[model samples]
Target: MSILIDSAVVLKSYNNNIVSVTINEEERILFAKGIGFGKKFGDKIEKGTEVEKIFILEDEDNLRNFKQVIENVDENFLILCETMISYIENELKEDLDERIHVALVDHLNFAVQRLSNNEEIENPFLMEIKALYEKEYTLAEKVAETLQYEKGVNIPVGEIGFIALHIHSARNCGKLSNTLKSTHLINSIVEYVEKQIEVQIDKTSLDYARFVTHLRFAIKRILSDISIKNDFIKEIKSKYKLSYKIASGVSKILIEQLQKNVTVDEIAYLAMHIERLRIATIDK
Candidate 1:
């Protein structure tokens, strides 16, 4: 099968001779390898330039194959897939618009991959990526809570569903880091807080995941503090008396080093300190 480039494309980068080509329309990137000679001079393929190459794929199959590759390469592909499902659910019609879904997913994936350097993904080296995604998910939940408390705005459930998708995919990958696993535990506590507060926090803002990540790291530091100093648990429990059970669970696990003398007051302080630090650092 032969594929045609419909416009001037930038050589975003090259790996082992395979060029990552970018154009405006179709997000199905061109992976032309070893085309040889002058093509490497980076001539202006121009906005209207067209080149044909032979490959073992037709149009539809090529799109599907590229998407599958993306899914394997970037776990975040599930987020895109879920977004389309959400669209289908919200649509009033019985039959969902498949074409629109495909185009949107491809475009969104292409944009995010470049921003996140997601295309640089390694096949057998996905462990770090899985940890990164989970860390981001757990933190997103916390930031959502912080926003709701500070701004009186509730985070949308769709975004939480998306974050949940990331968490599930990361857990399924089974390569989370110790820090990410700790964040998972903290996420459960934050989720309980969200329920107690009776409010939803939206994470639709740009860079929301990044904000969550910072909070997670900051909160992790607090956990380290609790482990090092025995009094953190008692403080937190006293502060969030209504959330004492949830706070206590976090204290018991995080401050296991303290042993036997953990108190609600220390745990309450730990939560309060973490929230204060998170607000001081994360962007609004």
Candidate 2:
């Protein structure tokens, strides 16, 4: 019942517990306690040997994370980690970043252990996670359900949000550490503007789509220390006072949540987009 295909030759031993292997001439790192014990360079890993896990490190970052996991976690945990990842990849038909092998595995191992010990943690961003990441949340629920059925562990509902976060991070190449915060910030700003203008936004509208796109990049820029300068900041502030005021409120939320300063140019641009969206909503 071994699921592995394509026999691989051991290339090098990272340690007594981990080995680098090449399958079909393509290199991958394998982790199995005692798999590398007494194994030498260029040794062909025996077929049907139970490897705790194998990782295809596509880049240096992935390799680093894989090494960290191998160094820190036990072999049994890695097995569960690999199984969950394989299930998700096969079910979703998406290639997640290799980092999920480390992050999600670590989270689930700890979460399951804690729940077994009658300790539970609450997810503060659960509502936003459910709202913004519906697909990932659904997948997370299925993951929880599978674990409960197979492992006899009843993972808490709150863990679904945390799992959804990991799924989202993996799907987006691990750039969504603050995704829930970013989502909440965007929704709050949109809601604030809509209430101020006494209009409900059409989420299906192109203008709303454009506004969301703008906010998404704006959040990225703030996180990445990138800023834009608007030469007409004064003009924009004067011309769109109502929009500017709403944007200022959003700027405050960004500052509070991200602890990053938002430039007047960023505020002005947000205001301009908000004004456009407001106008569009009114016309509709």
Candidate 3:
């Protein structure tokens, strides 16, 4: 008598160490040491194969895009991406959106190639990225180390910011473009506030930190059409007239950029933060 085993049907193969398989009617990318060596489509892999990692992409588009990238990019580079993804999951203690697997891997492949070619990656929103997405930025810095070890290329700090952008976008199941828009909006508002108040923001200040955070959530709420109730909207308008005026200007900027009506309740909330920044400089 011979022993029998249940196995997954290989849907695609990505070299000597990785393969996409369909088992239990779910598509998964399996990674193990030499799992795909001499393996090809329609091969059966043991369901209990001792694997280092298995990525089950629940989203159909993500799975499709993942396979596309895996086929086009080098196996070594894809492995590098897998290493960073594993590290990111370990650091965050949560499974991220599968879209990240598609977006980040594609992004890192291009980034590594650009860096190898000595292309300058410029991030004008670098400071804003650091301030707004601190946790993701920290995680991205660690991922940069993995990139260095795997690819022998040192990821630039600006590229780290881009990684942070990807992480933050995927972590929240949001689009990178939306995050970039929010970052740009926040910086514009900050710049406008400085001009109106004749004061440069102290990025290190706790108050400034809270203000930027507020703006981030504020943009999220506005984009989601989630209005907040500000009981003291009238008081904010009356008491902090200067901040309110500045907030109104900021509202115009939001309307023009977002093309959505901004509630005065939000304007009041913005004024409150502006007032905090304005008050921080008083009697000093």
For this target, which candidate reaches the highest lDDT against the unseen true structure? Answer: 3
lDDT of 3 at 184: 83
Query: What lDDT tens digits, residue by residue, belong to model 1 across residues 1-284?
Result: 23354553434332322233444533333333433224543333444333332122224533444444444434334333433344333442343322223333443344344424434211221333235455544544553454356435455433433333333332332334753565576566446545644444333322223333333433433533322233445555556455555446555655553234444445554456444434433433
Candidate whose TM-score is highest: 3
Candidate 3, residue 149: the lDDT equals 84
Kindly indicate the candidate among 1 and 3 with the higher TM-score: 3
Displacement of residue 166 (Cα, Å) in model 2 is 0.5
Query: What TM-score against the true fold does each predicted structure earn?
Result: 0.26, 0.52, 0.60
Among residues 3 or more apart in sequence or in different chains, the pairs in candidate 3 whose N, CA or C atoms overlap within 3 Å are none
Q: Which stretches of candidate 1 lie over 4 Å from their true place?
A: 1-174, 177-186, 204-246, 249-269, 273-284
lDDT per residue as tens, model 3, 1-284: 11213478898777888888887777778877788888888989864568777787875655766777778789877877887887888888887767678777877888989998999567645787788789999999998988888788878898998788788766775456765677788899899999999988775454564576567666755765765667788888889999999999999999898888899888998999999988895534
Q: lDDT per prediction? A: 0.40, 0.75, 0.79
lDDT of the structure predicted as candidate 1: 0.40
Question: Mind giving the per-residue lDDT tens digits that candidate 2 earns over 167-238?
Answer: 876787534556566667888878887888899988644456457656766786677566465677899899
